[model samples]
Target chain A: MPSLPPIRPEDVAVAEKTRPHGAFDPPSDAHDPVRAGYLMRLGDDALILGQRLSEWCGHAPSVEVDLSLANVALDLIGQATLLLNEAGDADTLAFKRDVLDFRNCWLVEQPNGDFARTMVRQLLFSTWQHMLYQRLTASRDEALAGIAAKAVKEVAYHRELAAEWVIRLGDGTEESTKRTLDGLAWCWRFVPELFEVDAEVEAAVSAGIAVDPRDFEAEYRAEITRALGEAGLPVPDDQRPILGGRRGHHSEHLGHLLAIMQYLPRTYPDAKW
Target chain B: MSDWPLWEVFVRSKGGLAHRHFGSVHAPDAEIALRHARDTYTRRMEGVSLWVVRSSDIVASDPDDAGQLFEPAADKVYRHPTFYEIPDEVKHI
Candidate 1:
């Protein structure tokens, strides 16, 4: 692996102020409507997964793993906040939307199972995000580009952490190895959803505001292949694209997730922390 | 399972300065150790650089040697830069 460059204080200070361009603007037709939806979907994916990961807060295998998972969750939440805050006020988008209106894929809404399953989800999602964000950093849309630039750094670390755990679990004991393989098998079908392109994405690509999901397939495949290889796992031969999130049709899991997540605020609508 | 080891943390605030000891946290290894240090110590943007060292690796002077080690140096007037006077002509001294 390449050495990480030294982080300069000036760079950190600069990044603190780096936010989406649309943060100050309400959704406007002049600003590429398709791109706006695409950005929202990206934000929704991060937000949903972050919420899912937060479930493991007090339940990880160890303190080290707990903190590590929490850190990744925080990063995803931060990205979600930036993207959603730009799309509209974050609170409204996160709390006010109907379940059918959400744009996150079904895979992200699935309940985090055991440690192996969570790691499987993390590995699958972060690998896709790593490729997606890398391309997004250079997007023509300045705000999305800025968000992607900062996010790539966070997601890169997430990928590394997930990849490390996959190796450890896959190669460790017989029981762990079996569980890791089962976890991968359980999640493999959802992998195609990450690459499912939609009309909104097509328009965004035409407008040069977003990269086509199809563009990332090769890179995403290579990353997963290498990681699985190192883990002594085989790639399952079955490949089928599962589509819905981009169309605003999510799994049943999302409703349950939202109910729990929004309960505190919904029950006590005027409560303040 | 083996207990996670504690690590001492140091953080560099910005350019042109050395890292100072920040605090410590428990982690399984150095990579996760640094990540833990970042999440715990620098979440509020207190640092630009992080360094994590195993707590066990740090060597310390014995409490009995404190008088001979540090107290003797306190009385050395020649070692104090305050004894030297800088002329007004010097700009950054």
Candidate 2:
């Protein structure tokens, strides 16, 4: 794969503000790409993970689980729409972007492994997202704050749903425990990427357009630690963190995901309901 | 998953409404069952409250005894309030 071009922080910071077309009026600075990028990063996280979760639509272990996963997927997609709309036209951003334009964390783009693995990923991502949204609800940016206010409640339930499964699978029978641990191992490496603060993020933070995730890294870890401990699982030792995705540098998996996600939109280009 | 117990779900759509039977879900415990019920039955703002009980706990009437249990009530038309004269002041009744 071609290496992604380095993100230009100035390009993000200097873009002029423009009004959105719809009923939703974002804050005056919403079109500044730095702020837009900030919002897109959050939206991309939701959009990608929402797509991944929807893969379980007809394939979950039970009918109830299928509905639950789909429900969460829909919630994430809804969040993505609102967040992306703040940045630009949501449909165009979602369907027209190339792999290198995506700003999601690498964690969300990782493929869903087994059921246990999916639950583990959900637990980790939702916990961070919940905290992030809670902080964003207080942001000086009205659009970010308003989006976060609505999203915090959704991520709270997402956190609860995943935590319950993590505890159950980790402390359940031997086979389940094994699968859950394997899931954790597969997912643990990606946690640090969620907290990474790069130049764009730094700009967004310094401008008070975004929260510094590093500020709450300890609390985030403690939250995960508590959940792991309850599941009778030991926290894995911190290792090298898998980074990139915020800057559009993603693993091979994201390319595959984008190919599928962008297919219909790219194919017809004008197909509409 | 088939080995998991079945739970019957009840949903109260609004305050002052009794919970009516909604559907069933399979879960290992009541807490999970309640979560499943929320996802399955209330996704469309269908309920303000939810109740989940183990399906096995409900003692249902036997279909074989249906005639003896309910047929006698069908013939009692006087049990209807139509025999009473309507008082205009009580128009709602």
Candidate 3:
């Protein structure tokens, strides 16, 4: 029943972005504040990853791949837009928020090192995302459930595409196999963070509006293992797990990414599309 | 290191409809070719079904030889469905 007020059209560019996080919070608000933050983080993960994938629009190795990547990016961006829309205007939430305020996983923010690396990242994320949305389709919150229903279908295709590529490159020639191995290794460290049950997520799960990401870990591991095995690769030895993306800490890459992503909005200020 | 074979794609928009050629995409093998077809051609829900055929396997008649191949059929009145007149009671025809 609780919803954030829509921003006035004139204030979208300035007042919304400049206002601090707590500035809009009402002390006696009825809903769980942490759950609201969880939704925002979920939206953030999609938005940031969407932005990362969009970087490959014209640069993928083949024209088919270029279109595939763009399609996937478009899907994630659509999810982000809707999820963010639940909180506030999607544009302000995406382009206006500072890096520290973003709540995406570090795995998504990593630069696309190569076609193999990008595919590996997609494989990892989509596999996890497919399961996440599948479970979230039953979320007690109807809005989240509806979004999950639509999102699971899209992520299913993304998972299939990425998994196939992982197998192709892993079973491919010497160079491609080497690249898949390296790409898998590069992405290995971020695996644990995808299921991190931080405070907001915990609260959301307790409220039944979110899935406890931990519940999907067993299947997540099995699916990734299966995809990697199909690719003829071994799982890397566990490294110290990276955390904190849920808490808004990110790698060096996201700031630079945002610098470009936010440039137009920051530069033009009130300029309308 | 070699590029995938070229495959022409066909899409059926609905049940009981004929598949029509949409476009071609290149993939390393048949399965990949089908996937590429799905990704490249059907992302918009444009098709209910898909078919992919290797460009090499299809023996397409040369367009330059069209007159020699089938041009004679164009003037064959007996081959036309409309060549026979139906009685007035045969309204559906």
Candidate 4:
């Protein structure tokens, strides 16, 4: 056999061209604050929920569930990194931002009350995210489209895993069913806010940078209804619409969450790994 | 739950490879067992395919009979391929 040539930095660079992570070249043009805000909103949703799920790292009911929850959390955090990077410096965006500046919807920031509650919130969010990402894969913004394409597969698994737990618990023992119903009821009110399209959302939709969630409102409702039906549960009555997360108005929960998440970074602002 | 059944997992690392036993997981049922196996063993792209079966379903030989079953074969060197002769041109053998 012929002797192999010494590897060079240039050859390593060429070999890395086919690597998936960090392969997508983000657009270099400056984006107005509005467009940047849109990307941050998407990123915040993943980041906040990822943080919530990570709280279960050492505390989930079983080893199997613990791994599964952490798996999904890592996937969400990975998506958040890509999205926040597109908006600006991902570290600054995630570690330095104040609660009022966060754009994640209220659902993700809700406490992980129990396994049932966690799965309920996950099911509600991942279903909506999966549907939205399916459409976003066709976004006019190439960066968003690429992010969506990769994220859609992860979100699909999240949705399936959540649905599995929701159905199993909802239809299992009486206590499990009661807990599942309580989770559904508590999470139901926030469902409407997910599809609420405000002025900024409208601008993004009009520019083809985002899909109009209103277009799928009926389908979303039907999907929830079907899932609930399988669980032998009823849809909760429509409560007063709890809105304003998009504009940075949030419930008290987000502040507490931010306190813990930002503590290390806030205290030692210049620290690096 | 403690009552949950244990499942043995086998994984095929890639195409054209037979599945080798990887590990096990506990789950309430077959469907969840498959998922638990995937989460537990295949999270790092360790396998392209997974198979999960209830551990109780597997039929394993008794370890106490190991001498009678396997040791006799180890000493039977004449039954082995060590005595085979081949041409210098032979490669795979």
**With candidate 3 superimposed using the best TM-score fit, by how many Å does residue B30's alpha carbon deviate from the native?**
1.7
Candidate 3 residue runs with Cα over 4 Å from true position: A1-32, B83-93
lDDT of 3 by residue, B6-29 (tens): 999999988878899999998888
* lDDT for residue A216 in candidate 2, whole number 0-100: 89
Ten-residue stretch with the least lDDT total in model 4 chain B: B84-93
Between candidates 1 and 4, name the one with more favorable lDDT. Answer: 4
Per-residue CA lDDT of model 2 for A1-273, tens digit only, reads 998887587765554334336465544655597889999999999999999999898999999899999999999999999989888878889999999999998889888889999999999999999999999998989878999999899999999999999999999999999999998998899999999999999999989989999988999999999999999999998878988888889999989988888899899997974
Best by lDDT: 2
For model 3, the chain A TM-score is 0.88
lDDT of 4 at B46: 91
Superposed model 2: Cα runs more than 4 Å off: A1-30, B82-93
TM-score of each: 0.82, 0.90, 0.87, 0.90
- Candidate 1 per-residue lDDT over residues A5-116, each given as its tens digit: 8889999789768966644666454355576588789989999999999999999887657777888898999999888876766777888888988999877888898899
Which lDDT tens digits does candidate 4 get at residues A208-252? 889998888888888878887888878889998899999999999
Q: Which has the better DockQ: candidate 1, or candidate 3?
A: 3
Model 1 spans > 4 angstroms off: A1-25, A30-33, A239-241, A270-273, B64-79, B85-93
* Candidate 4 Cα outliers beyond 4 Å, as residue runs: A1-27, B78-93
Q: Please give the distance, in angstroms, between residue A251's alpha carbon in candidate 2 and its true position after superposition.
A: 0.4
True contacts kept of each: 0.24, 1.00, 0.71, 0.82
lDDT of each: 0.85, 0.92, 0.86, 0.90
Candidate 4 local lDDT, B1-93, one digit each (tens): 798999999999998788999989999998888888888999889999999989999999999999899998987888978777888997544
Interface RMSD of 3: 2.1
